[model samples]
Target: MRLKDPMKRLNAGLLIIAFVLSLFAGRLVQLQGIDSGKYEALAMDQRLRRIELPAVRGTITDASGRPLALTQEARGVFADPSLIDPAKRTEVAARLSSMLGLDVQKVLEAISTPDSRYVVLAHSVTPEKGRLVLSLGYRGIGVVPESRRSYPSDAVAANVVGFVNQAGDGGAGLEYAQNKLLKGVPGWQRVEISAGDGQHIPMGEGQTQEPVPGQGLRLHLDQDIQWEAQTALADAVKEFKAESGTVVVMTPDGRVLAMASVPTFDPNEYAKADSSELQNRVVQEAFEPGSTGKVITAGALLEEGLVTPESTFDVPDHLWKYDKKFKDSHEHETYKNITFGGILAKSSNVGTIMASENLPDDKLYNYLTAFGFGAETGVGLPGETRGLLHPPSTWSGTDRYPISFGQTVSVNSLQMASVYATIANGGVRVTPTLVAGTLDEDGAFTAAPAPASRRVISEATSHQLIRMLEGAVGREGTAPAAQIPGYRVAGKTGTAERYVEKAGGYKGYTASFAGMAPADDPQLVVQVVLQDPKKKYYGGDTAAPVFQKVMSFALKSRKVPPTGTVAPTLKMFAD
Candidate 1:
């Protein structure tokens, strides 16, 4: 090898240094001047990643703090499609399918998508399954922890509390109506990005923002009382062979303690049931109230000072005029002149019409409106109906006559309950409430206030009406089965012929019983209705027994003290 001179070596070193400097300068210019925006964006993309954190939904509790609906932590499985190898897609999908019960082919297709970076394998998988999947040490598999809405009471207040969909949105009942209050805000997180396959890398910014959970709801439903009502209503439906049935129990102050409908559906399995079964019939379905509406008619008449409890009427069996023959549900070969109280106790249509004949159509309509008829209660529920009560001006001659006996008009079970509640609470009509309060994410209570009441009848008139109703449950009156052993229950029984849309006439019947217990100091009002009972269709036989079972349990559960030692006056008809 030829030895180079020292000058040549020094020159070569300088040139090498120049070359290195130029290369470095070119790189600096490319980063800072030519593509500065791209470099800045790459730096930010490495330092941050937007991630959505769902808010926790609140609990739904009954009056006694029993949870009817609640939330539980669940994990959602997802796959990093870009990181998953095309060859192993089938294998990975098969493993996940076996574990999560997902379709293997579908999952494989999802993970093998060319442009997609992520795919959700399953949602709401149990903790055990999630842990098993996590232990697999798969590079592309990931999990996002989430909260799922659950019904602890299951079918128990299904229609009232309602349910949430997969997207965690409210669908019906209080859930849909109060969505704004129930659904809380969501939050987000950020993370670093790495080189090559765009993988997440930790950069010390720690979970960027903590998620805020959803608010809770407190309902006026008493779980025990609700159970009582449901049991009774279900039994009535089966025993009477009814198409459907509804029962409503509320406090004298208008808080709905319990509302049950037979042929009810479970919220968890709501998708499997018919739309009709999901409805709250107490507020939805309307029926001709029959003799039970005598209470309202009596209220109107007494409030206007048109009749007294002791007033006598020489009522005949057949009112031939108006093409309407008024007859008692029970036959009387030899009718006797009875007192106003007797007429009501026997539920005579002639007596009721005679009493209502003097009141103007305007007065009747006004009273009905005051009692919350032909109007929605404005409860926070989905599809609340304003029942059909035709304007009094539309009343025909026969229509007027039949309306006096609750034939032409239609009212819901809830409205019927409120009518008795109004009488029980000294003629003050209060709006019914389902939810008691809402609890914010911070555990602060935002309670709903009790509805205001309007007086529709005098205290004296209310008391007089109670006395007359007392006679209806006494000896020589109908609804003898409604008599409880220890408590003094006063109520009315109704058997209305259901109108047939196809036939354009009345064919079937709806048996109903509406009353307030203990008559002296009313604590609760309950209504029971059975539609289209087979074999026996009388309200006294078909519906009254169901009321007895529920009322007995309700009195015991609420610890309502008995008013007197006197037993319910038993009545019997001659064989």
Candidate 2:
């Protein structure tokens, strides 16, 4: 009986041991099979860190590869509010504020929130500033390398290159128009790091996908010419005490060499610039072209064979149209017989209107439309305005006559400039383009799509109009100031009274000069417009002088050969 009891106790002990082992095995299965993914995810959350890799914006360059807008490498300063010491918070805030130009109170508020693990202190912290902050050994504050958008030349091409916002995206000008191509794809970095310090863990796994850099832009603008145009426009505006001004320089090929607007601002400190200064007035502001519209009328009539250059018209001092009577800029003796070219040289409103009498309103309107009036130039700049061009049905019987002289018709600076450029280009209208092409990081170039082009008038007629325009620049003509010393120049001067909403009539005057140089075989076309001049408001006195300077500089700079000889003599008036 003693032996049996011992054996039974042994068996019971073994059975207890087996049951305990089975329970442990079942627990192991639950942990290793059903809940394995859940614990693994929890460990990954604590161990791995994800850092966003920012993409850079493209560089904007002048035609000569001069940097206008660039993405400069910089460092961004940030703070971990959860890690910041409460007692030393004030001192830390002051240090950051002084070094980074941040507001002290704003930094204090950001550092005081314990729930925030990340708070941005300065967006574009310079490397020097970042080093200074890090040298102070603030435990919670950190610095990371980033890109700071910079304009190297302050206010040089303000309206063209524009300025970027806090997010580093282009907000205006060419930057805004080509935003998609300029901004590159962003990427990410996955790294295993300690949660407490954000330091890479020893023997940790990491993977990084580098961000692709953006393509670079190459513009059609010559930096030197742009500087000249901007300087000239600014000087003219200040000298005349005008409200605003604009100048556009182009070539026969329709390349916009420079487009400048006054009331300008430095794009570098765009935040301080007013909204009005940011607008590119060359393409946005519209005005009645006044007598400048005569070029289109002359060309239209000449192209249709309705009038020859030597055709005669009896020009009276004043013509009554409906209740309104039209008069010249100043009273002049009536010409009993005036050739078409002579009328243009004198800018006779009566002469131009009488010439337009033969052409139907529909034909005149079509010619105006063909000249690119009342439409966008598709220059690809943002905020481009299409000036108003009403249909023929909207015009009264007398409206056509006034429209012939550039009243009751509106056009922007570029449109007006393009009119002369068309004539200079032998009547083929080429779309004006600012962008030359895009350059990739590999130093490869992608040319911008060629601008659309179409013929507006016969080349033979263009030659005849060019001859008349040359007469308009003669000493006896309106724009004697537009004469260049060596080059044979051709252009027109226009002074149009600006309309007032309250008066429903003209108030201020917009003086404008549009012309091309080396008239025999033109290479460049320069346009200048001055608005609300406090001094002299005539196009010949105010705007024509500006054109002279710009065209002179461009002609000399381009090294264009001079015609040397005087223009062909046009009969001032037919006897």
Candidate 3:
């Protein structure tokens, strides 16, 4: 009986062994054939890592090819939180915090996040610092290629060049206006990694998509001129105890050589700048333009044959209109007959209104529009105000009278400068431009389209207006201080009652001077505006000196030889 039981047990054991072997063979077949693709995909998903390849940003250069704003090579530090040990996270965070200048609690929170697979520790890390971070050999830590924006000229042209944000996006100025052209496409790379340590596997399968670099911008801004203008504007703003100031220097054909705004910020440290300091006030803010706008009235009168440089008007100390009494800057006895050129030279508000009384309202408004008022100059800058100009239809009962004498109408600095630029360029108004052209990745420059131009008045009328403006810089003129030594200077002074929004009314003066050098043969136009200056609010007293300083520098820098011709004498009061 015992021998028979032993044989039965042996047979049962053999049967069980055969069934277990069959199960193992079937499982092997499923793994190797039926479900092989699914398993292999899961394994690859766990081992493969993707690294971003950041594209190089473009450079912004000045007219002389000097770098103003540029991008430098940098690094982005990251971590795989899932691969870091939970117990070692605190120690890792402490080490990283000390090396990277990060708060330990922030680092710990980042590394200990629940269900987080990846996290960024820092961006824009220097290459040396990045290499030091890598040398720590901490598991789950990695460094990727990135970029950082740099402003070499700093605040020199910061208001014009603008700045980029932490995300590498253009935040303001030309940067925001031309972001798409300045920011290029980014690429990536896929590589196999060691699952045990979260490190790149040497000689592992890898693929790459190379990045395309961004195109660069070449501006018409001359760095040297920009520096000089900025320095001068800053000094004037401080000296005058003014709220703010702006200076724009351009060629007769509308090529902006330098555009500077006081209280500007450095693009490198833009985050700390006040919002007001970031604005490009030259094109963004508008004012009444004061006597500087008299050139338009003079142009209108001359074009209609209503007056000439020698024409005479009855001079009065004050003239009463509908609701306002207009007078010159100073009170004096009425002169019997003041020459038309003398009215502008003396900057007499009553004289300007009296001279333009014969002109039709529509003709005056048409001339204003023709001279580039009430419109954007298309200067290629953002936040440009078209300025306030009530049409003839919208004019109030007394609007026509004030509008004629450069009151009740609004214009930006660039617009007023272009007005003088028109007369300077043979009566043609050229659209102002700051960008000279763009450079491709290969460094080939394609010049920007030529500035648009249209004649606003006859060449003869422009010449007559130029002669009248020259009188404004004469010894008896208001802006005599604007005269540059050895140069035939011509310019106009402006002192308008500035409207203050916080006070909700006009409280202070906007003093300004718009001028051109070598008036006989003009080459450069410089416009200076000081807002709400204290002590001396007259344009002649405050703004003209700034004009002289910047104009002298620009004229000498451009090598514009003086015509050496003496200005013609104009009769101020009739004999």
Q: Which candidate is the best by lDDT?
A: 3
Write the residue-wise lDDT of candidate 1 on 1-575 in tens digits. 44379888888889999999999999999999999999887777554546667788778899888988878888878777777767777888999999998889898888887876556788767788888987876667777676777887777877787788767788877777777667778787775434344445655343667767778888889998888788888877887788999988887778998889877888876667788788888887888899898887888888888877767777776666556567767666534556777778888888788878898888887888888889887565778777778887787766767777788788888888898998999989888888888888676888887677899888888888888887787766788888988788888889888986668888899998988888888998889999999968988888888878888888888899899855333221211
Using TM-score as the measure, the top candidate is: 3
lDDT tens string, model 2, 1-575?
35568789899889999999999988888788888888877887665656566788888998889999988888877777766779999999998888887799999998897666667777766788878887887767777667888898888888988888877678999878888778787777765645565444657876788988888899988878888999999999999989899999999878988899998898878989889899999998888898988999999999999999999978888888788788888887788788999889888898888888889898889989898999998788888888878999999868898888898888889988888889999999998888899989775879998899999999999999999999999988899999888789999989898875568888889999999989999999999999889899989999999999999988887788897777789877766
lDDT of candidates 1 onward, in order: 0.80, 0.86, 0.89
CA error at residue 34 for candidate 2, angstroms: 9.2
Candidate 2: clashing pairs of residues: none
| Winner on TM-score (1 vs 2) | 2
Per-residue lDDT, model 2, residue 178, is 83
Clashes of each: 2, 0, 0
Q: Measured by TM-score, how close is model 1 to the native structure?
A: 0.88
Candidate 3 lDDT by residue in tens digits, 24-141? 9899889988999999888887777777776777889999899998889888888888889888998999999999889999999998888765688988888999999889888888
Candidate 1 — worst ten consecutive residues by lDDT sum?
Answer: 566-575
- TM-score of every model? 0.88, 0.91, 0.94
Error of 1 at 96 (Å): 3.8
Model 3, position 418: C-alpha lDDT score: 92
